[model samples]
Target chain A: MNDLAFRLRDARATLSAVAVFVALFALYTLNHPAGFSANVVQTAANKGVLLAFVAVGQTFVVLTAGIDLSVGAVFILANCLASVVVTGSPGAVALGVAAVLGTGLACGLANGALVVYGRLQPIVATIASGAIYFGLALALRPEPGGDVDSTLADAVTGQLAFGVPASAVVLLAVMLLVWVPFRRSLIGRAVYAVGSAEASAYLSGLPIRRARLLAYASAGLFSAMGGLMLAFFTYSGEASASNASTYTLDSIAAIVIGGVSLFGGAGSAVGAVFGALIFRTINDLLFVFDLDPLWQPLFLGLVLLGAVSLGSARLLRLKNRLELFGS
Target chain B: MTVPTTPVAPAPASPPMSAPARRRFDPAVATAFGCIVALLLLGSLYSTRFLSPDYLLQQLQVGSFLALVATGLMVVVLLGQIDLSVPWIVTVGGMMATAAAGHGPLGAALAIPFGVLCGVAFGLFNGLGVAYLRVPSMIFTLGVDAVAQGLMVLKTGGSAPQDMATPLMRDLATGRALGPVPNAVWVWLLVGTATSFLLSRTTYGRAVYAVGNREAAAYLSGVRTRRVTLAAFALSGGLSALSGALLAGYSGKAYQGMGDGYLLPAIAAVVLGGTSILGGRGTYLGTTAGVILITLLQSILSVVQMPDAGRQVIYGAVILAMLLLYGRGAKIGA
Candidate 1:
């Protein structure tokens, strides 16, 4: 009973995020012109999964009480690289995937090395690295053009049997294969420990630096996965500054809505996936209602602000105001 | 695993020298000056025209916009909080000023102040969220930024805004004054003077540094930390708005995304000035040097016709180098 209770407590944020996502999704489908069809679901899933992968990658870093502002740039970089390479035969496509993932790992490692070894702040370090990554992307694809293997892209992005979305399944598989094992491992626990209290984690002999480095590496890997997905979806690569920035901002929002604390040491990738889905639903809702797309940012902004305010509501109950500064 | 230590000069002056006075004469300021001199020499290698008084003054004029934004950023950062809403607040100021000026004579008269007032209001909202509600400043300010962008978009119907700047604004921003100096430089000097005075002479400034150094401790010492945070954010907002308005005037029109370029550079300038990103240490003089350096760098990059990618790469690399250099001994995070 005690174990179950602790588990529930641990998953509280994720559960809340799930509830919010379900509610938003229901409203979206009810109002969607197509009305809960598999087609709508697939389209939404495909879009949401892009951000989901990025947000999940972000979760790894945020869990360690740090942030990776370069995820979007890395995503764009991987997309550009994949567009150039993820063509030809199956063997060639496989190699291309490996190369793209490797590039992402290198980027993440660079960010980790700067933060952990060079002793720069994560925010500033990532901002700098993000620019570098975007620069590389721009150099690779100054203008959007290139191709992915159509067969591979179709297989991955296409619908599965029973009218299910393949992308949603991929997201689940990723969670099971990557996130579950990470969450169960000692190193994963170290990531959480470091995020919760870096000094305490260090004093307790946790390998904080290694955990942090791994977190960043995984972030890079996942964002690269997102990039590959983007290549598959778009059938080409474009090094778009606006898209990169939007993804970066949206990933943060998704993480927040997904119940992952920005301060770290808590939350799950599952929550983040749900957050991304909810965010996507907002776009669908806007579309279905036929409102001017101009109002989208405003509506989204209000929701984001509301969600953030809700998260901070606990502060009002604090007896001592000084505690506010510490958190 | 070697920790870098900042080597402090060992009591070179007399014992009677005050600690604040000593800090005011930080070696960072000296380094900033050194960097300006070195960069200028580098610029001269490109052409003698780079060293011309007219060219240097032109660069200073261009840099003033960044310097103004950095002034406000320095205040909020000094309190260990950041304002990411700077971009849209700048837009709001510029757009509002331009729209108002289009309304006729009275509107033209109120245009600049009107834009600045919008910034102050937005800043207050940011302050309320971070200070009163205790939202983390980063996320809160970002949310505010999104809302501001949305509002601006809605106001302009997602196209380029229609209004242009008043002649007065254009003159203030781009006109020549005192013979050779650009009017923008004069405006920057005014903002700089007020900022320096606020940081050095006022009790509130002392409160800001103290709160930034350690907010909980400052509260314990009876400082109203919340009020200090609110004021800092408000000042930051107002300044960002003022800068935006100036930018609009300089460009001769207000548009949808005029504020985008200033956000990162403003933060970069503040941090480059040796003001701790983590807060509680820095000087406006250093920020001034930082603004000048960044502006000159931009001019040089443009002169060399470096592609956008190359420029971004250099910018990011330089920022990382600066962070490593300045923050070698600074302890960051909660």
Candidate 2:
């Protein structure tokens, strides 16, 4: 019973996030003009999955108590790169994907090096690196035109069996292949330890540097994946400042809503995926309710504020004021 | 096995500093000033016009906008908190001021103050969340920024706002009230002086540094840390709004995303000025140097006619290099 209780507690944030997404999604479908159609689900899934990928990436860094502000920039850079190279024959597309992913890894490793080795603060370091990444994206696509391999794009973005989104399936596959194994690994445990209490973790002889490096590298890889998906979805790439900043902010929001502590050392990528879905659903909810498009930012903002405020409510329960400063 | 308890010995005291009489000059501030001079020289190589007093004064005028924004950011940074709501608060200030101006002459006269007050209100909201609710200032301010963005969008209906800057605002922002010196530059100097005085001379300023250094310790010492945080954020918001209002005046109109370009640059200037990102350790002199360095660099980049991409790359690279030079020694944690 104790074990079960501990497990439940561990999963509480993720579960609540899942519940919120379900409730919001139900409202969305119920109010949709077309009503719960595969097309509607597929479109929503496609959009949500893009943010989900970035959020998952953000989760890795956030789990280590650091943030990857460059994730969105890397995502956009990958989009630009993929649009240029993820075309032509199958082998060419494969090579292009590898190159894009490699770039993401390089970017992540750079951030890791700056924070871990160079001893720079994560926030300022990432801000500077994010600028560099966005610059590269701008250089790659001076204009807003490029093409992706249509066949691959269609296959990835299209609906699959039983009206399931291919993008959703891909997301599940990533969670299973990437997040699950990582979660069960030694380094992953170290990542959690480091976030929970870095000094103690270091004193305990954990691989602090390696764990942080891997976390940041994985963030880069996942952001790259998101960028690739974006290329497929849009069939082109643009070095859009608005899109880059929006995704970065939204990814942070999704992670927060997903119950991942900004203080780090808690939560799962699964929660972040749900959080991303919930965020995407807010837009759809507005659409279905016939609200002005201009109201979207306000609605999204309110939801974010509510979610964040709800999370911080636990602060009121602390008996000692000193405990307020603990985390 | 019985464990024997031993009494802990007092820690040995170290010797007193031999250099207690050393001057208070900060090398970081010196280095920043050095960079600013180097930038001016480099720009002169591209165009002799850069060395001309007219051009240099003009750059300072243009830089005052950013300087004002960074002044606010420095206060918040000193408090060991950040306000991501700066961008939207800035926009809200500009838009609201212009919107107010549309009412009449009285409304026009009150526009700038109205805009700044709106920003103060948003800052208070951010402070409440961070101080009382204990939400991370980063995410809390970001949420507030979104709300501000949404409100602006709803008001403007996703288009350019119709209101124009009041004549007085235009006069203050773009006018050369005292010879070649822009009135905006004078305004910035005034704010800067007040800030310098606040950070160095006031008891509240000392408390801000104390709270930033260690909140629990500050609290134990009877410092009203929460109120300090609140006041710092409010000041940051007001200044950011003031900068935005000036920007609107300079441009003769307010628009969506008008404040977008200032956030990163303002932050960069603050940090570049040798202000600690983690809070509690920096000088206003350093920030002033940082603001001047950034302005000169921008002018040089434009003089060379570098592409936007290259400019961004160089911009990021320079900030990173400077950070690597002085902003090292942080541990591997948020």
Cα lDDT of model 1 by residue, B1-334, tens digit: 5877888768754457787787767776677677778878987887878889999999999999888888999999999888989989999999999988977799999999999999999999999999988887888898999999999999999455557999988998999957889999999999899889989889998999999999998999999999999999999999999998999999998887888888777877777777887889888888898898778877888888899889878878877876776655434332
Candidate 2: residue pairs that collide: none
Off by over 4 Å in 2: B1-23, B158-162, B330-334
Q: What number of backbone clashes does candidate 1 have, counting pairs of residues 3 or more apart or in separate chains?
A: 0
| Predictions in order: chain A TM-score | 0.98, 0.98
lDDT leader: 2
lDDT values for all models: 0.88, 0.90
* Displacement of the residue A194 alpha carbon in candidate 1, Å: 1.2
Give each prediction's root-mean-square deviation over alpha carbons: 4.8, 3.6
lDDT (C-alpha) at residue B293 in model 1: 75
Clashing pairs in 1: none
